[model samples]
Target: MSDGWILGLDLGTSGLRGVITDETGEIHAEAAAPLTDQSPTTWSAALSGVLLELKPHLSRVHHIIADATSSTVMLWDNGVSSPVLMYDDGRATQEYAAIRDQLPADSAAHGATSTLSKVLWLRNHCPVSSGTRIAHQVDWLNAQFLGFPPPTDWNNALKLGYDPIREQWPDVIEQLLSPLSPPKVVPSGTPLGSVQEAVQDTWGFPHQCTVHAGTTDSIAGFLAAGAQALGDAVSSLGTTLALKIVSERPIFSPSHGIYSHRLGRRWLAGGASNVGGGSLLEMFSLEQVRALSKRQPGPKRGIACYPLRGVGERFPEADAKKAGLWPDKHLPEAVRFQAIVEALVAIEKKGYERLHALGAPAPQRIFCVGGGCRNAMWQRLRSAQLPHVVAQTVERPPAWGVTRLLADEGP
Candidate 1:
């Protein structure tokens, strides 16, 4: 491969981000656009807005790849799109319940929010014919540029019942979804040939520019953090704290909400904690949280706090009725804040312990990302608890990692 620019697009729930990078993985330009809803067209506009920002570099961009939130999918008939299903869309409760007993606890398809459930929900309520197929978020976006939806990556196919171990779609899922099938599966970084001439003309890119497969948003973030070796991990401290580690083998435990994503030859496995920055903010405003985090946090406070935000807890333990347990209101506000922050740290600690108990290696080194990772005091708190949490980090936009996919000289 010769020297040329590459584009990595990330279609996140809150927004869409794109980065232009050289073949060396050095980022040159980055752009983003806001997203208001789950509409597929919104994703397209966001992509165009980002590309327009880098229009000057579009011609030199020879390869393009993208990542989208895992499980966000829509149905396609022949070649047209249906209403998109957001990742958190959980209207598949009945369907999930029907099959939940049949699946082993280790199955990724055991949740209502899973692609497997969402597709079943659509099938039961919506109509489907011979040409009908489920398309993940990235798949739909790729279809726009490729003239038809190309194959999906293995990482995105995980929640859709593609067995990475078997390297094929399992018969159980195939039989269940009989008519409602998943898109063709491919490993991340597989080139899908040239861009549609119309898209090429509209985007001002060369007709020969290729579109390559990309993975899930979280998986892209893992790659962006540059943690590839065994035991390397990432803790995304965003709305929720998510843990993922590189392991030689896969790990899955429906009990603890743990599931592994197939990445090349290794596996990225861990669960997410319901309590994190969002929970922290519920106790105080963003500004107040920032200001409070700068304080000493005062010896983990005598008063304990669970600080859960919603009705259920998945990681560290699974309880459908779990609710936030807060310190008394009469207590000093700052003290309560410290207790909550400490509680969040505790959840992070136990999440990793859960992964370890399930056979994943203890994190040799952890690279943190997300908005909360910027909190200096929070890092201090985490480092004090988990020494392996790296202070200095190289967290790139998720887009940057997907760019590496097409930037590579692989097939």
Candidate 2:
């Protein structure tokens, strides 16, 4: 039987999942729905499907917790909000060019995928009303449950230019969108409001159920990883390889492809490298890559290959125009394989170095999370490349950490 159950929904970039867990982190029931970079109607429909699957056990669930993929922006207007753009939508190149012109010469352009660029793109393309307010994905989701406009949580607001350290949206946001509505800002874990009475009734949840302000999935995953203090970093390897290091102070590195985020009690500073395993897979079929790994000792090869397939360059290199797959000349499969592995390891190492150089505490140990942790060869390569540091993988995914958080009580 379920006891002190909580519902944690992960609104991931690939899909949506709901896990019902007890106070001790035991998952009792779960449901998931497939999704993609679709419109608001699509996301709503998918979420509804997943919730309906959890209907039979609804009575056991106490709190509803959720966090969507970060930086996805939506338009809030006429009570019928719609998803205008996704974080990866590159249609905003022109908008990005415009923003760079406004930014300080020292302030490198915000990544093309940032929420600010998305907002600018929509404003330029769609005829949104001047009264419209734009919000991150999860913020809009919270608004749906509250039956009113909802504010963005601090962490998710970072990419939108909300000053988390100061707890205020930047004035530039107003200046950029002259008649645009300003979004209210809230702290992570703060309850936006109680779930709408009608939704409560339909879902068989308590009428007094609170709707906690959700964050990005990555932020929730990091929190769930049991990273007790600062100087800890979490790396996720999926469609993209991303590293996030928690810092006591804000660390901005537009040059390093770095973006700053506020998570739990500290700020998350790191960058996403364009060259992840996925991009490598494109050049070498999965079967071929696995076969090659059997003959290669990875870091032992000493070949240099700076990953970067399509997305420009970030960190260490810091050149947005830097071309990917460097060195016009070529090398053998074994060397290329080693270079590829080292390239990613280099990103990990350089990231740590950059963070330390910025005055952040050094990480004594890095807790590895995500699919990359499962790759035995990748682990060996990382160990060889980072001999000074220890990397350990958790059997379960960091996403499961979200379930653990919902089931526990904390301040």
The residue-by-residue lDDT of candidate 2 on 205-322, one tens digit each, is 7765676766788777775665536777766665567777778887777766666676655677777767677755756777767777666373365555676777566665468677
TM-score of each: 0.95, 0.89
RMSD versus native structure for model 1: 1.9
Q: Spell out the clash pairs found in candidate 2.
A: 256-315
User: In order, what is each prediction's RMSD in angstroms?
Assistant: 1.9, 3.1
Tens digits of per-residue lDDT for model 1, 1-411: 445788889998899998989888888888999998878677778878887898888898888889999999888887666778888898899999998877656678888988999999888877789888888999887777799868999989999888877778877888788787667888888888789998888878887798888899998888888887789989999988899999888988877888898877788898887888898778789888888888875676456678888788888787778887988888888888877777888889888888888899999999988987887667778989984888777878899977755544421
Q: Which ten residues in a row are the worst by lDDT in model 1?
A: 402-411
What are the clashing pairs of model 1? none
Candidate 1, residue 384: Cα displacement in angstroms equals 0.8
The CA lDDT at 70 in model 1 is 92
